[model samples]
Target: MARFVLVSDTTLSRNYRSVPLLDFLASAPTDALPNAIYSFLKGPPPPAAEGRAALAPYAVRKLEASLLKHYSKDEVVVAHEDHISEFIDEDTEVIGVSTMDPLGLGPLTMSYAVFFETRAHAYVQREFESLLARINKARSGKKAKLLVGGPGVWELTVRPEELDRNKIDFAFQGEADDIAGDLFRYVSDDSGEKTEFFRGYQTFNANFRKEWEPNPKFISRYQFSKQFPALEEIPDIVNPSVKGMVEVMRGCGIGCDFCEVTLRPLRYYSPERVRREIEVNVRSGQSNAWLHTDEVFAYQHGRHYVPNEEALLDLLRAVMSTPGITRTNPTHGRISIPAAYPDLMKKMSSIMGAGRNNWIGLQVGIETGSDRLASTHMPNKTLPLKVGPDGSWSDIVWRGTYVMNKHYWRPAFTVQVGQAGETPEDNWDTVALINRMSNSSLDNGLPFEFTVTPMQNVPLGLLKSRDFDSVKLDQSQLAVYYASYRHLAKMAARDATSASSDTNVAARYVTGALVGVGGWVMFQQVKSICRKGGLDLEKAARHGLSERPQVPSIAVIR
Candidate 1:
């Protein structure tokens, strides 16, 4: 009945409500018993007393409105997750599904295989397959085309049969705004057949690489300025994750090698535009929100990643001064904004929460600690400083951490384990940095408190040569890997005992004990490695194994 039916995946549709004990275990039936026990010990789902989580997916919401403006009334219809059946009838011509990661890649991959080891997010994969089934249900010889796109669209291409079996005709990777009209036209034409990848990415030759690489074409600021969705455009919130998710800006001009943001050009909304969006959110009943940006601190940055402190302050004032904005958090950002301009950090933190709870969850990319590695891999990550000469990577990192701690900001630190062309010294140097942060204590406690994220390489960025599993780590790297888990495990323990509203005492207590013990065991092994002066793989390989009793083991968790 329509030109194209647009929908979001289950991961995006449902508000990210915390899973119940049984719900969490439903992901892995084989390990359900253990997962249940684990949930009971670590963190149990809140009793049904907590109501259903609800919110709209920002992408789908924006796209639905954008496409709505472009198309006539009967030509387009936006469907919610629950009402998916109504739109997938015989008359449906095209289905556009948006997802962050349809496959078990990125954070979800690490969650089950590495962190929990309990097959978490199995529901995500199943939901993806379920979406395919829904799309296929009305295909009584109708042959409606299926198109998928999003942050993790490339992950699906790795498994070619998924595209073929699912009848996925095209995947519009990166920003597809420019080609939306073309897609609609192609779908309308009965004779036209689409390729598996986007037109721009079709030329990417993945013949020689170990993985399928899709070259994404970024929309420059000159061509694509972001247009915020109008208030009335937002449909009812069926499932909600976080309130007030506004797009303050797009693209990180810094061009970090590992991130997808660098591939695009930098552009932002005016303060008035930002305020208008905030007022819309307040009217819609979302008091708190995490502003979506590749790099929030880098908003209004000039050609060389320079900070426009006054402009930033004005923008923050506009956001914070809005009638009902209780909390404002950044989706992701670089460290230089706070490190270079400490005053801004203090002012921003004060505006968000000056007197009461000042804790804010921020995503910061502190990929590696090795100076040479930082220089070679992500030179522009820290502004105005070339690695080794201007300031050592460690110093820059330490200073940033100190500044964050001083301002009472708790950041979620993303640290990569194994990267291409990294030496053993580079690995050890990273471990040493983590150790220093763990050991640092000021004013009777740790100046900086953060959850360490052990990031693995994905096919999305410059290092798309191999899958995450292909990464090999030496003993020192293993120590660092376990260290992150251990640190987080301890934090989980504290959360279990803490007086937070969502804290599950029984589950967190059990999880804390398990993680604490596991971390302690890892610590003991690491201590022995430290006694032996860490992993000297080259020296050990050069010397026969006949001399050393313990030949260090590498974990292959594929």
Candidate 2:
């Protein structure tokens, strides 16, 4: 029997019809989104090949590669979720599961919970529980130690009771590429000094500083910088990853006060390293390279966070030169780069072959539009451009969107409400920014293409207490939600049909129809919720339209 069997939570295994951003559907409450629709959106599970997953999530694949460095191929198996039972036998010593948002306490999941006023478990949490039940059942007679890791492990740290509730032996809290071999050995042996690992997980205080507390059920890196794997220490994937996903870098140095990613030291992957991973995905018939990073602009950055234009271009060139990469886009980036460097945006778009038929999708965290909040929370996000000298934070975002849309790039923006020191006016500024962008058109007369999602700034105390129902959206927060959904419905109706990547024409049309209809229905529900919360819908719809300035397009600026 395989000694190490790695798997990811079920929510991460599906292809999601190859539609961009459809994976977010798992964050919705299982009660709110019927299982039929969820399954249809997630598409079929990856085909099982000899009881092994045909494709696994990128993180699980990374762990598998790490384990392979110390174990034989037959001793390590990346089991498909449905076929996990086939791999677990009497000799299995460790079963490692990686997940994201296992408890539905993530920002988006919590936002839905608070806005919808439902305590129902999100599809992510539901799937994780179901997977654990299956795993526990299969390993009943065996001595396989269950170890959970990944971004979602932090949630378990917040709610330690879940370790006992789910029958998990240990929850690893940090990146394990450097220590995977020893970690597995430690668990398998079950007796050691434990000097290499911290028995507790790391958490952030109210001011967002790192803090560690004792917990026998959790383990974190003893020394973060020393334990974080270096660029050469990390390994390339030996198996195909879902979504053609590959990491170009490890940390975001933008240092947003509210973000934890900044706390980790930056480690960039060389272009050769990136190309090798893309080649692995290409062999699996994945043509689209989804580059994963906290901030694409920070890759090989120059002083003061100014994007290294040449390095960025070289990276895209490496991706495009891959044998089967038809399209490419980074997972996250800051808008300030596009605002401050239009030529670079055009150059990168050309490298990626972005145009009307192939719009590059990017996720940008435009947390708030108010200059006060932007400067207060994420001062470095506006690097290379001062808020007052360049323009307001919203102005920078507007110019960035203008530049991106001109080059056929659609940004999926995420805004936050209920910040630590936020006032109603701060939220109104966010509404105004969304309205202004929604009503504005491109230089080519095409309406600006983008989608905005409002996420609640949920506190750790609330999440740990599992008191999500006690959270309520005030009038201003509700206005942000209404404004956000209003624009989302428009984008869905306009782009859903064309955005699908499904090979079957009939399936694509069906998926598009459902998406369009679902958008309208969800907006109606959001409207009702806002009205009950005493928000003025009409005012929100027209918040900044009248004051939108006719700024010159970025094409002529530089």
Candidate 3:
């Protein structure tokens, strides 16, 4: 019998491109496909490589090969999460859950999914708790330690009560890669010091390393050897994460104050390593990839983190030459990439044969427009540097947007509401920037697209002590929030998602309008309902969010 059962939440189990009806209706096209055909209407996303079938074999290999010396490959089982009860019985000594959001703190979970799914956060929480309950029920009171780790571990660590109630043994925050082997040993030999950033279940009383550096343990370990998973190892059962996922590098990777992984030093994998990972995915019948990086252009930097054109272009060329990577989707980039290397940006676009197609959508962080806020929360976020004649934030945003669009890359921005020390002037500035980008364009005929997430002061972020309840939204900030939802919905229709694989784009606009008018009132209901752990948003909306317009009425406007 296997000694451990490892599984991620529902998000990682599906195809990366697979944005289901609920998830799709809330945002731009699923994964924003550059190719016209597969963007949507392709049908349900094929299962992700992390699915029970696809990933179990990989876990076995990783465990037996080297990652785990305490157990054989045969001792590791990747059970279908929904059928967790069937596999997590007496024989299972440890249950390791990998989730992105256990308490529904993610912006996607809070800002977007809250409207249609109604009480969405609570629903997601129930689903997660139910899964945990399944393990407990199957274990039948036997001592199978429950280990939880992921980007969302903060949601639990922030509230120790949840960990105790759920009986979680260990919770590891930040990147879990470096400590995976050590974690395995903790289960196998039951010996090891408590990890630096990681805490035992009841250590809620223990303070973070320091106050200003809320999540200091999140920093990267320069000495840790980065492991590249064999394409065979991290399989997706439902659908692929569009091509495959390959981490090109990590460091100062965006440095967004609200991000779980921030303030990290820059590091890049050798081009040879990147190429091999891509080849592995190609061999596994998957082409293309969602390149994981803090900044694409920051690849192979020389000194002081300046863009190295040769290194950046060489990495792109290596990825392109990889037998089958047609579409290249990056996780996040600063508005400065196109600013610093306009010529190389166009060249890189051409190398990928994105001749004139600007549909290559990327997640860019433009958290706020106020220079003061930018300098305070995330000084390094602004691309091209604000010195000399480089242009102002507005200029960089507009110029970068124009440059990137010209090269066929559709960039979707991320704007936050509860930034540290945001003033009335800052809110107005944010709205003005949103308006400016809206007028400029989200795509050819589309307006700018951005998701406005309320800044929750989770334990791992710089503002960990900042309370979400205290971060109230003023009228100007509320206006920014409303506008962001409407524009993004419209961008979805124009984002080229098809009916073949996702919800009709027309419905997207309708839902957007409902949420567009819902404002913070709707968001509060989402939180309130979540605290109550209920899934019926309609009931919550009616009783708590009475001001929210009915979806049917919004449909008429559409």
TM-score of each: 0.74, 0.98, 0.72
- CA lDDT, every prediction? 0.57, 0.89, 0.53
For model 1, residues 421-476, the per-residue Cα lDDT tens digits are: 77767766666666556555445565346667565543444224334344444565
Clashes counted in candidate 3 amount to 28
For this target, which candidate reaches the highest TM-score against the unseen true structure?
Answer: 2
Q: Single out the weakest 10-residue window by summed lDDT for candidate 1.
A: 549-558
Q: Candidate 2: misplaced stretches above 4 Å?
A: 223-225, 547-558
Candidate 1 vs candidate 2: the lDDT winner is: 2
Note each model's CA RMSD in angstroms: 8.9, 1.5, 10.3
lDDT of model 2 at position 15: 76
What overall lDDT, based on C-alpha atoms, would model 1 receive against the true structure? 0.57
For model 2, residues 1-558, the per-residue Cα lDDT tens digits are 799999999999887777776878999998899899998989888888999998999999999999999999999999999999889989999999999999998889888999998999999999999999999999997899999999998889889999999999999988899899989988888774746788888887776777888888887777554758888889999999998899999989898988888888899998999999999999989998999999999999999998898899999999999998999999999999999889999999999999989999999999998999999999999988888877889888999999999998999999998788999899999998998899889867799999998888787788878787777788888989999999989998998788688887888988998889988999999999899888889988888777655563332234
**lDDT measured at residue 539 in model 2 versus the true structure, 0 to 100:** 84
- What would the TM-score be for candidate 3 when compared with the true structure? 0.72
lDDT of 3 by residue, 1-558 (tens): 667777665444444233322332222222222223222322233343333444322222223233344456557666666666656666677787766567665665444332323332333455467678777777767767787765567666556467778766666544434355655656544454444323232122332222222332222222233322333333222212233667677665545555535445555687777777667667667766667776776777655556787887788888888877776766667776676657877777877777444356666777776767877776666644652245556556666676677777766676766555777677666666655565554336544433433322223342244234443444555555545544444444444233112234554444343333333344454445443543333332222112321111000000
User: Top lDDT: which candidate number?
Assistant: 2
Report lDDT (Cα) of residue 546, candidate 1: 30
Q: For model 2, which pairs clash?
A: none
